[model samples]
Target: MDLDRFTRQSETEWRVAPFGKMRVPAVIYATEDLIRDMDDKVFEQITNVAMLRGIQKAAFAMPDAHWGYGFPIGGVAAFDPDEGGVISAGGVGFDISCGMRSLHTGLTPDAIERHKSELADALYRSVPAGLGSTGKIHLDPLEMDAMLEGGARWAIERGYGRAEDLERIEEGGRMAGAEPGNVSDKAKKRQRKEMGTLGSGNHYLEVQRVTRILDQTSAAGFGLHEGDTLITIHCGSRGLGHQIGTEFLKKMAIAAAESGIELPDRELACAPINSPIGVLYLGAMRAAINCALANRQIITHLVRAAFARIFPDARLDLLYDVSHNTCKLEEHWLDGARKKLFVHRKGATRAFGPGHPELPESLRPIGQPVLIGGSMGTASYVLVGTSEGMGLAFGSACHGAGRRMSRHKAYKTWMGRQVIDELAQRGILIRSPSSRGVAEEAPGAYKEVSGVVDATDEAGLARKVARLEPVICIKG
Candidate 1:
């Protein structure tokens, strides 16, 4: 936190030299105040990431970087498989491919204000939440396997969402090389009835209105405008992703031991890229990615159905859906050559620059939409990836306003009931099953999203396009 302890590269950037087995440097992008608020463990964890096998460049942390399970939540590191790179469960986190998706509503803020109460109640009733929640769709073993393989396409086939929606999602809603056989029965059981539900904790479906347009040109490209209504869904594959991560971490520890790979932290259990265990984990992780894609897609249909009930003429169009946690195989020109590398983005999002072939055609010129979800009762932002990101941090950016305090700490110090009432008084309608959760996710628990976005833009990770404020929030 002490700027004096780090080499001040810029007003919003700091560099820490290699220490304790680190193969490269660790760079953190944050303002002086932001860095001062950072948890000490983030620096330690990020430095450890630099020591990993086949690390091509420096280990970087975004402005929202915070202490997490293994890697710092906002950490980014790319490793070359050809150079004996390794995959760490800690690097991917438990919620594999957990991400945010935004949908545009063809209504103005005034239109939503007229029936806000009824709409909020309808949404709370329609969407399932809390721990152990289940929904109407229950999958059999065969169906589950197909769902894992098919991803969002499976849901569209089952009449959950429109077929055209797939194009707006990452990997077109399904990542290839997913092998359901690598997924355990226990994980399948956990996901059986979670389809079309908004699971608990930091996850929600919100009705929002665009409040500020930062870049009019890019905003037009993203179909966003001030006062236009939109919906943001934040959730993941539910218990299935957790089960898979838990099950694999145990296996990878043994694999790590057999390979004589010494990890700075036990939570960073990993295996070499060419190792049998690593291959299995990648296959299973890809399946979990599919699960998350399918889950969000089904939830999208539910949103459409809810809208149809109130406004028969209303149309909900997909903006973009991208994962925040996962390792991706992407080619980045490094050291004067195009090399395929395994880029691990734990609590980060891929901010592919303009002209990248993976971007949706409509967004090619503007670059990929990077949605940054805020904490409860705060504002989220829409940003676009910049080519500068490709050179600075492997096309990665912060996923959210990182928590300033842990959930446990927040619960112990704050009152959830008061937090909820205050937000409601401010015209933000919120519905949650647990008051404790409301306290844990109190807006004050996170860093200012504005600060995070500014740092991101200055750091060349992403450029702001629009800012959105919540009108209705269905908390998990």
Candidate 2:
């Protein structure tokens, strides 16, 4: 936060000197104004991440970077196992696979304006939300295992979504190496009836209209044009992912001490990547990723059904879905050789470049679609991955407009009722169980989304394509 103490790399980039015991220098990508607005603790936490073992390149922070449990919420880091890389629980936050999924609505905004209220009501009724909300599907232990291993595919098999949907989802809707046995019974119990439900806090189902086009070629490739309607779903693995991260952090601390791993911060407590504890955590984390994918998949079905009521011929086609959390074993060029690295992206989206074999066939020509959610009443962006992203960040980008103030601060400073009324006046319909919840996610509580996306594109993390403004917001 002290601009005078750091070296300026650009208008939106800065470098902190090598601090005590840091293996690599730390770099932060944020406008000078945004940097000054950040809490000082973010610098401390990012520096702590720089001290971690086997961390490759630099400890990087995105434009939306903000103070978090350990790593900054919008942090990106990759570790090499051959160099004694470690996997930290704090690297991946409580909301495992908390991600965004966008659906392409072929209709223009004019086509849906007449039925907006009807569609919003239908969506609010169809999708269960709010704190402790449960869905129609309640999975038993045996069935839950199938869901964990199957991911969205398991749901598609049961008629939740079409097979074509898998091609647009990250990892084809199923994360490899998910081990349901590693997840505890309590965590499983919490998620049993939570499938297809949108949990509370910064999560919502939004109806948006493409308001601007930045790249004609990319926009055309994505079937997006100004005035086109689209649906964006934001949520995660719900209570189960939090439980998994909570239970394992305690176990990892003990493992860290036993393994003689010296952590600069207790929150960075971790285990060797190949250790028994690490392997189990990875397996469990992947299972949670699947849970999130399955959760979003079912929600997609609900959104489609809700739209069908208003527009009889409406069919919601998957644009793209991506996960923001979890440590993955990926092959990247490191130290001039192709070595497998364990990439940990906490609050970061994987921005795979064009022609990457892993990308969905439809997206191969245009690159992966990076959905960056904005604060309520703000403009969200549709970006595509680039080769520059691969070189700069191992193909990673900011996930959202990061929190400017904590929820506790937002609740204390703003009136929930007033916030709801303010947004409603702007033609944004908000449906939530608690007025206080609305206050906690006030747009003022987040950084300007356009600024964040601008920094992201400048940093070569992703290329901007289109901008989306919410027409109706269904909150939890």
Candidate 3:
């Protein structure tokens, strides 16, 4: 957090000059205060990332950069396979493909108020939540493999959601290269009953109301209105993702020595992209991505069913689904030529700019929807990718208001009952099995989302579309 450690490149950009063992410089996009507020671990991790093999461009961090397991949570680094690129397990995080999925309810804020409590209770009863939660539907070994391979498409085929919903999902709800066989049996078993369940810790199902439109054009394109109510689910591949990360992190750590790659940090364990171990990790990681997509799809179905029980005529359509903490093979323009690179985004969201071929046809003109969830009892934002961001960050943006304090610190300083009561006083409803969980996610435990989004836009990572205030929050 020492400003003297970095040289100012511009108002929003800070540079760490490449030195000892670093292959490239590290760059961070943030305002002066945000940078000063950032944890020192972030700078250390970014510099470590720069020393990795085949690193293309500078290792970068978004405005929400904060200390994480290995890399800074809001980290972005691309590596070229042709240049002996290495795929890092730490860069992907433990909860693989953890993401946000937003739904558009065809009702206004006033309509939600009429049956808010009923809807909240209904959702709580219908959607399994909290630690070790299980859903009504269970997957057998064969069915689990199918779900991991087919993703949301398989869930839709099994009557979870509509066929049309796939259009709004990333990779059409199924990431390529998913090999269920590559995943460990233990990992698959852990996820057997977790689908459609919102596992604890940062995962939640929130109902929000659009309070303001920041960009009329993009907001219109995204089917947004001032008072429209929306529901957003934030989760990941449950225990399966965690198991894969734990298993592979150890494998990569051992392989790093065998492969003759010097690691600046042991936590940044990695393997060559073409190595056998790396290939297996990619296959297993892709399966985890599909698991997350399928999980969100099933949760969306449960949300619709819960809403129907309250409002018979209610219609909740998919807005967009995006995953963070992923390493995607994407084509990015660098220097003068287009190169295929494995872009690792940890605690960051992909913000593919307008007209990118990877986007769905309907959203191509406006670019991909970037869902930015705020902390508990806070307001979230919707943003769209911009051409400027594509040029700057390989079309990447901040995922949320990154954590400002540790969970342990929060529990020591605040009480769950007080936090819940304070939020309730502000007309925000909170429902959770664990009172301590609520305190750990207190709004004060995170950086200001508005400032993060403003810095993101100022740095040309993404353009804000609409701001949404939480009406009901069902945290895990």
Alpha-carbon TM-score of each model against the true structure: 0.98, 0.97, 0.99
TM-score of 2: 0.97
Candidate lDDT values, in order:
0.89, 0.89, 0.93
Which one is best on TM-score?
3
Question: Which candidate order results from sorting by lDDT in descending order?
Answer: 3, 1, 2
- Cα shift from native, residue 24, model 1 (Å): 1.5
| 19-111 per-residue lDDT for model 1 (tens digits) | 779888889988888899888888878888888888878888999999987799999988888888988888899999899999999898878
Error of 2 at 435 (Å): 0.5
Candidate 3, pairs of clashing residues: none
RMSD of 1: 1.1
lDDT winner among the candidates? Answer: 3
Error of 3 at 452 (Å): 0.7
**Candidate 3 per-residue lDDT over residues 324-407, each given as its tens digit:** 899989999999899999999999999999999999999999999999999989999999999889988799999999888899
Answer with 1 or 2, whichever has the higher lDDT: 1
RMSD of 2: 1.3
Off by over 4 Å in 2: none
